[model samples]
Target: MPTILVADDDANIRELVCLFLRNDGFDTVEAKDGKEALTVYTSVHIDLVVLDIMMPNMDGWALCKELRKRSPDLPLLMLTARGETWEKVKGFELGTDDYLTKPFDPLELTVRVKSLLKRYKMAFTQTIQFGSITLDRKTYKVLCGANSLVLPLKEFELLYKLSGTPGQVFTREQLIDQIWGMDYAGDDRTIDVHIKRLRERFVGTPDFCIETVRGLGYRLEIMS
Candidate 1:
């Protein structure tokens, strides 16, 4: 599960969001204000952060800047009642990845979280590792602790391509072109079948797992 830090002053809002996000299969950490948010952020390997604009002690705009400086590639989402165009432009200028107006739909928030993860992955690159499992992009082998597992041609290439940017959601069409040739006569379910076998061989990795983005595609999420 992807871990998100949710910062808001309103007790009810923070609790409600954590409840809904947990129900959506995401792991969430809560903060009551900007300072607390920063503290939580520095202490954890947070995948995404949600900040409310009008909080006490540092507000979302300032917090956004702080977080951006910490990790230029970190994904930040701002939530506030201010829906004005100027406020949004200001948030974007400060490096927020997405902004949502208050009284926002819980479902929409979840969707935004996934979208930000996808966007951040596109903009960044790093070795994908979780626990003792490492997806070596160059060799197309999963290094599990002291051992290595070599995958089939399709599975190796597919996992290697995804490892190029972990957390990136790849649609079936894109995967087909990357693995089997675009001219290959196959359905999307063919991708699913291969994914099933890949997961079976990917052993000893409870923290690293492939996630099916509902109504979209697949993304490999490595939890810290």
Candidate 2:
């Protein structure tokens, strides 16, 4: 069973959320504020975190950023009373995998948690293969037939991320955060340049292709 960290200042809300999660078969640890949450998180093996925006000592935004820095693959969900669009945007920018407003249905929250976990599990592999190409994350090398190609760090990471979740569209902002880090100050178009280079590099390979979703983002598709 996955252990979840539930952080909220409201004692009642915290307990309620914990109760629901426990009933749903997830082991949980609770924290009253972001400071306590960070302590608990570092002390234990937490698979995911559900946090509130407002808290004394430290706010969820700071906690989220810190947590993302600690574990880029860890799942984070923002559960707060602040349901504004800007708040949601900020949460995503800070690396929250999902968001739930106050007065949320416990069932819906559980479903989203399960979904995030499933997605994470699917994308956690160290190696991926399609057709004749093999991407080895441990060695940061791509093996194609008798040839082995070593790519730049960013390019390899971007390719690994896309190939890990083939056919899943990733927004430019999402790519930037996951690949370039949340603090990256460069233009988002840098992704485009990298993508173009990747396309050129693999033009002769007929196994896979990366597609751009008009006005959305990109997805890698297996040609075979």
Candidate 3:
């Protein structure tokens, strides 16, 4: 069973979340503050975290940042009373998977959690083979034939996206929107940097070709 950590300062809110998640067949652990959340997370093998932004001892922003440093792929869903766009943006920047403002529907929360888990699978799977390279999605470890290559998260996700569609071309805009979600401001250069890094890591690998179209965008070059 999937375990979820629900951290909210308000007792009623925490109980409500726990009840809803438990009804959905998820095992839940509750925490009254961010500090308790971290402690519970360390003690138990939590599959996902639902964190409220406002709390005593520690805040959700700090917790999210710290957790991402320890486990980059740990799915985080931030709950906040502040519904401002900047707050939501900040949450994403801190590596939060999703954001829900106060007074959110229980069904929406469940749906968001399910979606994050689905993406987490794509990001943390082992032994994703494309061309001749075997990329471990979980640890971002890449292996070409018998040799292991180190690749960063952005580069790995870029390659993973391209590998899913061998002959398809993705514009820089599309890549930015898809990968960064609402985090980036449609910067084409970010896409370029990741693509360059991917090319450098898999330099001589025929299956790791990222071809650029002059008037179009970029695509995974299918090497025959």
Candidate 4:
């Protein structure tokens, strides 16, 4: 089960959030302040953080900055009583994945948490494995038994996006737009080149392979 840290100065609010998350099949750790949140953060492999903005000891903005420094991709959702537009803007500026104003329905909170975890699977989550292949997304490294390789930026992102949703074909245009950006002036062949490199790097491994979807696109296939 995934672990989550709930940080809020209000003990009641923290416990309530944890209870709802627990009911949603998640293990939750609680912290009453930003300082405690940081301490608890290191003690567990927290999948996501649901924290309030106005925390004691340290505010959410400060802690969010600190957390980003430690793990740039960690999914963070802010819970705060302040519903002002500027406050939400500041939270986003601080790199929060989602922000829920105070008095939010518990259902929405759960939905946001689930969304963040799903979206950031390659970032803060543990190593992803498909058969003998092991990928540490945080470090952009791939390991297959004794063989290992460090991928280039584009190659790493290509692999990550493909593996993100296994067996789902991503069209060449879609890959270019999403990975290379819509402003990319390069031809569609740019994606093919990156895919080719990924295949070459993992060619010797039987654990996973990129399959050509014939006239359509490509998909990451993990073999049995």
* Whole-model lDDT values for every prediction: 0.80, 0.87, 0.79, 0.81
Return the TM-score for candidate 3, rounded to 2 decimals: 0.63
TM-score of each: 0.56, 0.69, 0.63, 0.57
C-alpha displacement of 42 in model 1, angstroms?
1.2
Model 4 lDDT-worst window of ten: 118-127
Worst 10 residues of 2 by lDDT: 85-94
Give model 1's TM-score versus the native structure: 0.56
lDDT of 3 by residue, 82-198 (tens): 788667656766767677898999989988887667667654555567566776777777778788877767777788776654544556665776678657865678888888877
Better of 2 and 3 by lDDT: 2
Candidate 3's C-alpha runs over 4 A off are: 126-188, 192-224
Off by over 4 Å in 4: 122-224
Candidate number that wins on TM-score, 2 or 4: 2
Write the residue-wise lDDT of candidate 1 on 1-224 in tens digits.
Answer: 88999999999998888988899898999998999999998898899998999989989999998998788778888997978866766776576766789899988998888888875675454355667877666666778889888878888777766654566666676678667976988686888998888788875567667888655467777667
lDDT of 3: 0.79
Q: Relative to the unseen true structure, what is the C-alpha lDDT of residue 2 in candidate 1, on a scale of 0 to 100?
A: 89
lDDT of 2: 0.87
Clashing pairs in 2: none
RMSD to the true structure for each prediction, in A, is: 11.6, 4.9, 9.2, 9.7
Candidate 4 lDDT score relative to the true structure? 0.81
Clashes per model (N, Cα, C within 3 A): 0, 0, 0, 0
TM for candidate 4 is: 0.57
